[model samples]
Target: MENPFGAQTDSESGSAKSYALMTARGPQNCIESLHHPRPRAATRAGRSGVQSDYGSSKNLETKTPNSCPRKPTRFLTALSWQYPNEGVIKINTDGCRKGEDGHITARGVLRDSSGQWMRGFAVNLGIGQVLEVELWGIYLGLKIAWDIGCSSAVVLESDSATAVHLLNKNVEHFHPLATMLWGCQDYINKNWVCSIHHVYRECNMVADKVAELSSCLELGLSTFQDPSDSIRSFLSEGLLGVCRP
Candidate 1:
């Protein structure tokens, strides 16, 4: 099957397809954009056949609003109201820009099958790079483990292989953000010693979009100053929107 993270420039799935990764500075590069396809509407057009009208509430018993005063909850930062994370309770984490210069803030979300969200965090990082954002995703997952007092978690994923590999095997931290990353690494090392797996971008939809959405908003949200606010507020405000799985 073709990679969900990318699209085939030539219409054929196997025809010299390209995968695109967003740049820390701004929009994604054309080649990077080619790699991952946006979530689709229900039907073949979505291509994945994973589309549903989550907004439809035929009968909830509670008087439905005559008209949606705001967005129809189609999918804000998540891109889709229906996500792949089910009962598994996968924690999706992402990073975005921080200040005026567009410094990236690392954000994450935790959700279960019933669409219940447990937690979320948005950390503003001084370093602006995809690798760092990916690392932040991993760190946030580990932090969630510590929060829930879990000894180990099975579904730790990241879009960036560089960071995941670094965690898998100790490596030098060349970036300036290593200081911040170390805190997250320490949480995993001290709390959940092992069982961290590296997953592809396709599996990390929630976090990927969380990071993307954080970048889109001008919330001035950061974990460095007030972790509780960053993590807690992110969960309430961000997760309550259009979450998946």
Candidate 2:
């Protein structure tokens, strides 16, 4: 077959061919690819110095390219539970709050340089914000450590970075929990080798489990000298293996 506008076409053949000749554009005879045949008006626009409203001929090579979406890179950290230095006891604390009507519970577990659970405490804060519970956990953890002769050195760890920042005097804010902050600050000031840091929640599993258990108790504080079967499992899981990405 042939186009009436000085171009040829072969549609019934195994491959199709289409062409256009424009005398105004210096005998420009644009040939369309077998897959994409250019419309006659678009070919005429080329002669009138009009850019192709459609993409260029090169873009018609493939309607869709053969490319796979990239997968996101995975970041892995070998961070796991670690013991404190000699004469220093590491205290891991966590807090849990369920809902507006639920109770706020804070729990802390103290471990020696040998990773021995020296003492653990769980306080039922009745109902409070998560941040307040975390701060209370710190205050109680430090006080218990002091009472139990962990005074040589203390390394407090919490999952909540906000609470750790406040405890370490990294930032200051005035809230109802300011009293607990004052207590933590006073203890840190008096202790010569006291330090607080933020640890991944996986490394603080024992404290997290204890905190969840505190919410089940009947609105009171409880202390554990010998960890229960559940708490023991959480501590073992945290210390036994490296976290995989």
Candidate No. with top TM-score? 2
TM-scores for the candidates = 0.45, 0.66
* Model 2 TM-score, all chains together: 0.66
Candidate 1 — what's its lDDT? 0.43
lDDT of 1 by residue, 36-86 (tens): 122211122211111112221222233336686564534222222333334
lDDT of 2 by residue, 1-245 (tens): 22111212222222111111211221111111112221121111112111111111111122233353454443344456776667778888899988768567778889888788787776555655778778778877877777767767777788888776555442333344555565566566554467677777766778887777554453444566677776776667655654522
Q: How far does residue 165 in candidate 2 sit from its true spot (Å)?
A: 1.6
All-Cα superposition RMSD per candidate: 17.3, 35.5
Q: Going through the candidates in order, what is the number of backbone clashes in each?
A: 20, 0
Would you list the clashing residue pairs of candidate 2?
Answer: none
Best by lDDT: 2
